[model samples]
Target: MHVVSARERLLTAALDLFAEHGVSGTSLQMIADRLGVTKAAVYHQFQSKDDIVLAVIDPALNRLGPIADEAEAQRGNAARREQVLAGVVDLVVGFRKVSATLSFDPVVMRLVRAHPALRNLQRIRRLLGGTAPDPGSRVRMAVIAGGLMMAGADPAVTGLDDEDFRDHLLAAGRRILKG
Candidate 1:
């Protein structure tokens, strides 16, 4: 049987709570409660709530780093852009629940904006928009990113399977980037 680690359990509980209640609304004690553990158990694993928040987002950021790196290594702008879009679509679809929950959280957004991994996101945007994008390209990038996240949570499209969702999202991203 597969065993869940204490740290993994805590992070999972924390993410569920963060999704239900915004990050600012979630407390360490609440996380402990969700995990059916004492607050001390939580403290034993993480220094603070911020540490837990970072842990929750770290995996996604780690995955995104590789996507941007691979895209950057591509030969042409079209190839780089397509690669980044496909990779991002797959990432978002695969982690739909996590993406939807974290992307819309204001507190998480603030923390992520200050994170070092934000650089990778910027690199991806640059790859899509070029070295110095015009106002239109900037807007397009924002729309594509925001759309991808929002699509995951969108009830109308939730009926679609993962492959369909990924395909549609990638196609939409390509259309947006082409504009």
Candidate 2:
């Protein structure tokens, strides 16, 4: 049987709590309670609430790195853009709950901005919009990024299955980026 580590459990509980309550609103105690453990147990796994928050978001950010790398490896600009957009759509659709939680939270935004992993995001944006994007590409990139995040949480799209959502998102991203 597969065993879940204490740190993994703590990070999972923290992400759930962070999703339900914004990172600022969630406490170490809340994460502990979610996992049916003491706050000291949480501390044993992570030094502070900020540490827990970082641990929670780190994996999601890490996943983006490979997408950008794969996109960069593509032969042509259109192929690279499509590859990245498709990868992003798959990620957002597959992890809609986590995406929504990370994308919309104000505290998480602040933390992510200061995080070293923020370079992954900059790289993705540069890949999508070019090394030095014009104002129009900048606007398109912003809309595609924001729209991908919102697509995960938007109630209007909830009824659609993951494949449908991903396809629609990819189409919209293509239009925005290429048009």
Candidate 3:
């Protein structure tokens, strides 16, 4: 049985197609085919590919928000904060290639940049602190975001099982987040 929701099916199919082909290259028709639904049904759920692009953005980012927020809030000392950051990293890297592509997509990048919700992302980044006062916070946040994207795409990390990958990434995150 198709356990995935229609919205979810479309989204999963759309992301795979979007990453593989790009926004301009992909069509609702293609997405419908990927989901084994009629074009009209897909259209009913998402007005257009643009709508799909918008819908996917937050889910992708918010995947780690709970953990990120927790880490940001729970962290007290530098060492503790680093531990929370490490949890955030593990949360993001959990999505692996999907998150990697979502991060790098020029289309989504442009959309999020213009989207009103851009504030949401900006706040998250500020919390992550792309550059810290010690000149280290900036590097850690950069490393946190960039590293998650890269680690997702890396073959070495990809080949490992979820538990193994999480363990290694947590370790990596601890070191990087602390620096």
Candidate with the greatest TM-score versus the true structure:
1
| Cα displacement (Å) at residue 24, model 2 | 1.8
lDDT of 3 by residue, 45-98 (tens): 988788998887666556445554665665455543564556555655556756
* Total clashes for model 3: 4
Query: Could you say which candidate leads in lDDT?
Result: 1
Candidate 2 TM-score versus the reference: 0.87
Q: Write the per-residue lDDT of candidate 1 for residues 107-151, one digit (tens) a residue.
A: 778888888887887787787774554788778877987787578
Per-candidate TM-scores read: 0.89, 0.87, 0.77
Q: Model 3: runs farther than 4 Å from truth?
A: 63-65, 72-75, 115-131
Q: Residue pairs in steric clash, candidate 2?
A: none
Name the better of 2 and 3 by lDDT: 2
| CA RMSD per model (angstroms) | 1.9, 2.0, 3.1
Clashing pairs in 3: 130-138, 131-138, 132-137, 132-138
What tens digits encode model 2's per-residue C-alpha lDDT throughout 37-82?
A: 9999888888988888777767767778999999999999778888
Please report how far candidate 2 places residue 118 from its true position, in Å.
1.9
> Model 3 — TM-score against the truth?
0.77
lDDT of 2 at 173: 85
Clash pairs for candidate 1:
none
